[model samples]
Target: MEINDLTAAESRVWRAFHKGEPVAFGEGEAENPATGSDWGPERTVRASVLRALLLSTPQVDGEIPRLRLSGARVTGQLNLMYAVVDHPLHLRYCHFEESPDFYGSRLRQLNLRSSVLPSVSLASTRIDGPLRMTDCRVRGPVKLAGSQIAGALFMDGADITTSDPSVPVIQLHQSVLSDGFAAPGLRVRGEIRLDGATVGGSVNLEGAELSNPGGNALRAQSLEVRADIRARRLRAEGGVDLRGARIAGRLDLMRSRLSNPGGMALRASSCVIGELWLFRSEPLEGTLHLRRSRIDVLSFEPEVAPGEVLFNNLTYTALTPHEPADRRLPLLERDGDGYVPYAYEQLAAAYRHVGDEGAARRVQLAKQRRHRATLPWLGRVWGHLQDTTVGYGFRPLRAAVWLLSLLAAGSIVYALHHPRPLKAAEAPEFNPVFYTLDLLLPVISFGQEGAFAPTGGYQFLSYALILTGWILATTVIAGVSRSVTRQ
Candidate 1:
């Protein structure tokens, strides 16, 4: 029904709503209006009155059982600023031809369940209550700058298309996004921004297609989040940037595809991340920088395609010697295969930071060998070991263990072979007459067996044993040293 066809009473109600005033209609009050057709004008007036009331009040209690604005076309803006309501704002299958601004509007408590908005704009809107826009289609730009949302903002099976290429489909600037902001299986034609924003909860943009020809598909700058930022199966034709971001929780970008000619950066400068979970992500062509960042854990799929991943001056806080030895070496090896030296370099730095110079030297030597160049002077000891003919698996404690065992074995052999017998023939002439010189001599001889022995046979055996022990000790030491140095 057009605005001109309404009766005098209906016209008055519509004008009051357009002027931003509160209006209420009782049960069947529209059935007997003073002007126009009783049912037609009555229903129109009733709907207008309810819409105005909802827009004006801070909260709406009680229920208007059956109010319908189905398939209605709003020609002008539908501003719902600072309005709170307990009842649902049901506007299913509605169309807005022009821009409908809902800036600074607060929904205290109510679910926007299954509401359809073909085209709408909500810049700087605050929703303190639960909101659900399942199966909604937004054709225009959805600006959400400097907004504070308390409850869950779900947009399941939604489509956010951009009418203009220059405008972003979902713009979130310096906003506090708590709870969940999900848009699974959605198609977004323009870019999505969460720049300088803080998210207290998770953001799931799974199976979403973000395509922007001239702009970044997903850009999040200096973003801080408490929960995970999951974007699995997301396809971005443009680049994805998360520079200077911090995630206290996990970052799951599994099975996603990011392609851009300008390059995509996931830099986390001076930021602390919990876990970088990138499993089965497609071959990314851009650089992933994590300089001066701290990560508790990092995981990646071994079979995934190679990409340029850089980790310079990064600190792995959760790396411990007691952790499974097999888990510590794979990332470095894979990084070596991918032609990225920063991984090995950063691992070496981690060892050096923890006062493990031996391990650090080993890592440096490995890098030198992989690159086939002369190692630095500080890595000479490790470099010499790496060039040895025999290769052993890299381990630092193995050398110490082998050296101690050889020493213990040699001592036992020396003690077992040498034996001295006591004699009483030559005794000290006047020394108490109790202590005999023969007994003293035997004790002294036993104490200095190999040192003072005059017989060549004993000396030869002692030397042979010493040589053999030295050979074994040197061999084991060499193996361990080489293993660590080769990287």
Candidate 2:
């Protein structure tokens, strides 16, 4: 490009690039009225001239060749597909007539802070330094899929909206960032996909509002983050998918409002996270599916108990709030998958880990009750008998109480009417207490049950006592065996 062909603004930009200076047409404020739409050729720079300067211009010996233009109106599409730009590009507070295409480009650094563009395509692009688009507003998608950034990606306070509902507003799938992705206070009207992405540092998404109704607001399946994911107070309308995501640090969703009606609000199944902080101010409006996921610590203290949850096979070492088993049992009861023994067993193990043996037993007891509900009618009836008689082997004192009550009743009945002796020569004494003990104790014989025989009503009474003793003995043995097997 010849210097004589440059427009007034383009000439200033060209000179500034060679001299390593930023061309500022208006106040640095993003909403400065001087940089409004009424600007003429004096503030306009053609994209072709800017591209030429970045690609063909020779670098000065003493200065860096950078395109640092601010508060300017770019007229054409700055297509730099597959271009390798060594200079840092900074286009702050600028307005673009067409979206810039940087697909497969390798750049030293890229900053579009507070700029307004129709869209941006940086798919498969590689950045040596940070990619900063803080406070920028894009009307269409910002494609960054398969991109590799050596530095952090910042989009703080940016508003990225899209008319197309099927596509994501910001695509970071398969992207790798060394310093992580920060997007606090971001407002996105479509999905932000980070599937298969790897972030070296933490992801900070505080106070972001993502609205893609009836679809995924944030789809981050299989994302591997070396650090934490701080998403406190995030308001997502559609849902969030963190399935198979592996985070080294905490995934904090404290005070976040996630709603998708009947659908799952957060699907984090098969994930391996260090800690999950879900202490919300309000209850989750939809189901939270964490099936087959493993976490170190689960902080689940919601203001209201969640209604639907799918936590089958979820394994967590610890639980927050240190609540009793009763308080935590409600959460297991709300499992949408229904009668998941693994979930209950995991909770019991968690309680045991904290040295809460009583709570652990309570959890196991609840597990039995939950499992009983799914059994057949006869099985349930038998379960009820075991529950009432022995508290399903959890409360051993109940068995003792039943034994003592039956023993007392038998002793009183036999004391009122003594049975005839089988042989007068062999009979010792008719002690009702000893006789009742001999009848109840199935394993041992006191030599009195065989020595004596009952007649008429006494015979009927003896038969009833024998039957009752056998039933109680059989139930006790069954309960003991079940408890032993579980241990």
Among these predictions, the greatest lDDT belongs to: 2
Residues 350-424, candidate 2: write the lDDT tens digits.
Answer: 887888878987988888888899999999997887778777777888878887887788788888888889899
Per-model TM-score, in order, reads: 0.61, 0.95
Off by over 4 Å in 2: 30-35, 302-305, 482-487
- 461 Cα displacement, candidate 1 (Å): 27
After aligning candidate 1 to the native by TM-score, how far in Å is the CA of 177 from where it should be?
2.8
**What C-alpha lDDT, on a 0 to 100 scale, does residue 116 get in candidate 2?**
88
Best by TM-score: 2
lDDT of 1: 0.57
Candidate 1 local lDDT, 1-487, one digit each (tens): 4557665655654554433343333332222112222224333333444445455433323423222333333334566655444334544443444455567776553333233344554556677755565566677677777877787777767777777878768787688877768778778888888888888888788898888754688888788888888888988888777777888887777888777654553445567788776667886655566666788875555333244555556667534432232344454554413444766666666666666766666765566566543447666554555444222234435544543554455445445543332332432222211112112222223223322332356456546544544444454566666546645
Candidate 2 to truth, TM: 0.95
